[model samples]
Target: MAEEVPNSSNTVPIVGPEFARPQPSDLTIIGDTVKDTDGNKVFKVKTPLFGLHNKRILVDSNDSPIVTMKMKVTSKHDRWQVYRGSDLDDKIFTVKRPSTVQLKTRVEVFLKQNQTREVSCDFTIKGRFMKRACRIYVGDSTKIIAQVHEGDDRLVATIYPNVDSAFIVTLIFIFDLINMAGTGI
Candidate 1:
């Protein structure tokens, strides 16, 4: 089953009618013992869309909720946004027709480059791994927390640079944090 979030912060709306695939953050974990037909452990990663959802996020159309190794290799910094949507802050939002399963997926842009993402029906606490991040530095994600901009892209990281005053992102997964001074949430 899918959940509809009127809370703006929790949900994202897609453009097409055939948006039937379950989204990222919605990926499920069958079990530590769950295996694919080949007997390899099947750990599913929730996928996110490209373009923007409402005013907070931008989902890359090329980056689908289900990304396989077979897909194109993104060798560059594909742009992502959090304060604007596809319409560029336009209010003409088209909502999906609603379904039995929630298809909204949250895409995490890893700080490190070249980490493979998978598509599955699993929704794990990868987010919980991020709970304390935004607050520490209040960068791009801060814009999200402040209702400024929003996007589904997340860069996986650890508290590396709370170094002296601010967290210095020191890894390949480093995300560009755009902080608009003074909106002080």
Candidate 2:
């Protein structure tokens, strides 16, 4: 009987590995920020030129994001970091480039710094190792943002979960409950 039963209309298939959307804001991430038409998961950051002269990038196709970066230091030493931050409404991943940092994506931005010194560039990654760094976070699940900072401390290549609530509800209410009830039929 259970095998012949039907699940509710709410039953949604377990899509793929789910993850929460990336939030704006990660530690002292300064400089400029702008939004595009999609409004989420597609954007860019302009950080003070840091690290090796060339860009070493990373990307996860499983995720839906790809970051291509090129930075150069002008004055002062502000460590570059990308992590999560709060915008009073939700959690956002931030890219902090303090002091003088000029940036440009496919859009524009509102600057927070009062300084006028930065090293910048317009670039695209064409290497395999670099291609591996700018990963993509796709679907409605959790994933880790692989990053490279200027320090002996490097986050191991691992996944940071982005848990989606609606997916969870569908799993519990539609699948779990229906399966349980059907088993007794």
Candidate 3:
């Protein structure tokens, strides 16, 4: 069952509280390892060097599969799907650019339950990737759930309390994929 955060009536718990810290948490992604402020490895990303779909798997510190993200090859908007626990059939959400062309980085996220209608985004990310700054907001509202910024040697994400860090990490992974492909990184 999902636990709701107090006063956040519009938000849904993507994962659970175990993924969230009581205070704002700083997660740094360096190479395959995602570390916390105390330099503890929290997650790892397994990316294929050569693959048709550019599939990437996120694993926990204990090497358990958390989620798998893959780009949709035929998508014009740079769409991607995130699946639960390495199962493609268990798609949890979808992420994509709002348009094929944009002045800055803009992404829309739709949870599995919202994909049928997709009348509006369940969450949105907006910012400049070159500047290494972006914010994830609740639906179309300005209630920010997480924010990402460039660190000295890696990208740093500051996830707000009670928000699912795994979900934020997944979004950041997709954001990196979209921007890096554009810059040929």
lDDT of each: 0.21, 0.22, 0.81
Where model 1 places Cα greater than 4 Å from the true spot, the runs are 1-27, 31-66, 70-139, 142-185
Q: Which prediction has the highest lDDT against the true structure?
A: 3
Counting clashing residue pairs in each candidate, in order, gives 34, 45, 0
**lDDT (0-100) at residue 32 of candidate 2?**
22
lDDT of 1 at 44: 26
Candidate 1, residue 54: the lDDT equals: 14
Q: Which ten residues in a row have the lowest lDDT in candidate 1?
A: 164-173
Model 1 lDDT per residue over 19-104, tens place: 22232221111311112234443232222255322112222223222111111123222222211132333222111111222233
How do the candidates rank by lDDT, highest first? 3, 2, 1
Each model's RMSD to truth, in Å?
18.5, 21.4, 4.5
Across 1-185, the per-residue lDDT of candidate 2 in tens digits comes to 11111112222212222333233222111112222223332122322267553221212223322333222234132212111211222211112223232222110111123112322211111112212122212211122122212112221122123333222211111111122221210
Is candidate 2 or 3 superior in TM-score? 3
Compared to the true structure, candidate 1 yields what TM-score? 0.17
Of 2 and 3, the candidate ahead on lDDT is: 3
User: What is the TM-score of each predicted model, taking all chains together?
Assistant: 0.17, 0.21, 0.88
Which segments of candidate 3 are over 4 A away from where they belong? Answer: 1-12, 49-53, 182-185
